[model samples]
Target: MSKALDHDPDHWPRRLVAVTPVLPMLPILIVCALVLVGLVDGSGVTWVPLLATAPALAATTGGPRGVLCVGLLSAVLGVSLGIRGDAADGVLAVALASLLVVTLACAATSALRGRRERVLAAVRSVAEAAQQALLQPIPATVGPFQVAVRYSAAAAEARIGGDLYALVSTPHGVRLIVGDVRGKGLPAVGTAALVLGVFREAAHDEPDLLDVVARIERSLARNLGTDDFVTAVVAGYPRDGQLEVVNCGHAPPLLVRDSVVVPVEPVRPAPPLGLRTLSGETPDLQVLPFADGDQLLLYTDGVTEARNHDREFYPLAEGLARHTGDEPVDTVTALHGELLAHVGGRLHDDAALLLLRMPARTEAPAPREPSGTVRVESCSP
Candidate 1:
């Protein structure tokens, strides 16, 4: 029989609960010990009320039924302790009141925990909706290329990160962007939203790729903080066998031709968007041949900066060369898995990867003859 899968995501919590499977009755044992010691000491019924520890512990690890059982056990033993010690009426009353209070507090704790969990589930739903809005999913194929996108946020609870990516087919061609904002959480997300909003509108309207970038810069300048900026790579496929790229202080893109990968570093580096005043330089557009069977990888610095236990960074280019091949989806999936393994299955930063590969060419058709008949036919006929 095949081994059962523990990391099936859907059963993450279930699996952990199953693995430990400890009884939640340890609190009962603790209360029994305390009561025994109190009885051993003559008339020292003061420790009886400390049996409250039972309910408190039970509330954490036990369900409502289990908590009730523990609470009843604590009360019964506490009352027995008061009677055994021949305690005064006041002492007995105080002990009974203390146990009652503990039981009530346990009930309240369980109720609040359940309420918080419900609220957390609702918050998770909202986060998923917001993520879909911020990063519109990329299709598996666009234009003459196969495409794939892999994204992971550092904050596991957030489920979405500052990294942003989008691919849209426009009159200009298949234009896409991958970027990282300077900060994290909602503010970074807002900046990403601003960039994608402007990029989408600009990509469709502006034929020149650089013009699209300018629109985004202007949007960020108007809305973003003085210290905030986004590092991005904007790319387009305006025609077969050609690519247009603009880098805004982001990590260099990787290009794979014939299985040899190389970084396409910017020829003229410029400051990230929203800091154009510091550099006073418009980003340079790079035009290169993207022949058949070539692949382009766009990513954020998270891929490069991810460190292993020894503090060594993951080798992105080498890893791509090893994992990537003909299919963009398979390549990216394998590379992403490897990336997670390299970081011990959790990333400390938001990482994103977009792979685009032009499919191999099919045979060309034979040339067609001219429409008009030849003026002079060959001799004979």
Candidate 2:
């Protein structure tokens, strides 16, 4: 997900170009109205004088090229009218000058447009670089599992936001975190960074997933402001096939097996990290079967809360059911595409998806007989 930069006042040049195409036409329109009135009043062809406004109008509106075209056409019309009215060389000089002015103005406007486009290009490049550095990609393999993560911020330009996901292999086990901060911009990012940093360190030191959660809550309470909190799910995978998940006011993870989507039941969800004091009891760690070929999908509320043009919330379970399959990466890609399509293009909040799959475990070998004792007896015989 990427953050959008604040609006720039330096875009005046581009704005001028955008409005230039219309401003020059006003004078020609008024002159044309006067010409039509003169013709309707039975006056001599005094309307021919209005032809002089055409080139300047075109130049101001369409720039130099437009002016040139309008000038040439106006000159042709003026010469025809002058022949009929027997006008002098002075009128012809004025018509030629108008054409020249239109051409020059178009050239100048085109140059300004080119310069503005270049500047915009440079600004966009810098923004892209910043986004890349801020939201570096997670590797495909983390700990003992195959991991794939996809993230999209509602703002197309931003590469990250309040929604965050991270997987790290620690001495205790492989720990993962997915959470959504309450707001956006630097404040939200700062909170997310704080939570992730604490989670990574605590995951290694704290053997229990609940302890890790508590560590994160304490960290956030100290760093964040009064109302700020994070909705998060922290999970740990020991060497065994079972996964320990602790939900702190976060969306339940979806377990996919044989293309079936099932929401992992939380033992007891606690309040968001900073709001732990509101709850009487601490969150219990829920154990879920995580055999090989099974995938756990973690995401933020942005995906679940996405609404269509009709104001209907997207059915994420149904969408997942339709797209779930063997390949974790392909499944996520399809779901992400569907998500964007569901909302008609981009999302309004940060949406993140982390898919972790455990490969099928190899069968244990059968126990061997006591061959050493039999070999010794045979050798003695």
Candidate 3:
């Protein structure tokens, strides 16, 4: 749904493609038609007044120079037709005067349109660069899992929003986080960036997954307002057969094992980040068996909260089962497509989906030594 100005003609917006090419030539076409009409009717004065339309149409699609050219052409043709038809001098002068005024006015309008277009292009380029830095690209494969991500911003023109996700291969293992800020716009975006910055650094420094999350929480508490907070799920794959997760008031992640879709609800729910001081409860680490041929999905509330014309929330579990496949990219792509169709082609809120799948092992992979002891206080099937 994001509408960015594209330099490629083939990728230009539908509105521009339909209107841009024909407008410039419309002036000339109209002039030729008028000449034919004059030859048939034996009267040029009546149609000569209509020639003013030629320059007006040209103003929308061309620059000042092009408008001036079309205006000159219309004037020349009018003079010739008036002489041939022997029209009154006063009528011819009035017709010529109207055409001149229209041409000058249109020329100014064309110059202003061109200037605004250039400014828009420059702003779009800056936005793209900011997005690249904020949501650094992820590779198709990380550590022992296949990964895929899909994101949508409610403000399609900006192409970036409050929803955030990041996956990194650290000394500890494959670590990731998916979160949603409390609000929208620039404030939410700043908070998302803050969380990611802390997570990326802490994931590498702290061997325990809780410490990585705690670092983000502490940072947010010091920086965020009392009313502001972020709901997030921090997860890690530290060894061969186990996965660690800490859910902080966010949507439960879906686990796919043997074609069965199940939500991994937290054993002990904790307050969202930046609100821990109010609740005084720390998040519990839930360890689940992550064997080969299993896939896990992490998403923001925007995905589950989206409503259709029937006022029904999207059935994410059913959609995932229908689209699940060996390829992570293919599965996520199908889910994202179905999501857009459910919301009538545009989501009202920001949405993000990240799929992590452990491919079936053809041969046993060498055991990886655990970096640190994973303190698992709870377990989920």
User: What TM-score does candidate 1 get on C-alpha atoms?
Assistant: 0.81
Clashes found in each candidate (C-alpha, N, C closer than 3 A): 0, 10, 0
What order do you get sorting by lDDT, best first?
3, 1, 2
Query: lDDT: which candidate is best?
Result: 3
**What are the Cα lDDT values of the candidates?**
0.79, 0.69, 0.83
Q: TM-score of the candidate numbered 3?
A: 0.86
Cα displacement (Å) at residue 77, model 1: 5.0
Q: How far in Å is the alpha carbon of 346 misplaced in model 2?
A: 2.7
**Segments of candidate 2 deviating more than 4 angstroms:** 1-134, 278-281, 362-381
Error of 3 at 235 (Å): 0.7
Off by over 4 Å in 1: 1-15, 19-51, 62-69, 77-95, 362-381
Global lDDT for candidate 3? Answer: 0.83
Residue 240 of model 2 has an lDDT of 82
Model 1 whole-model lDDT (C-alpha atoms): 0.79
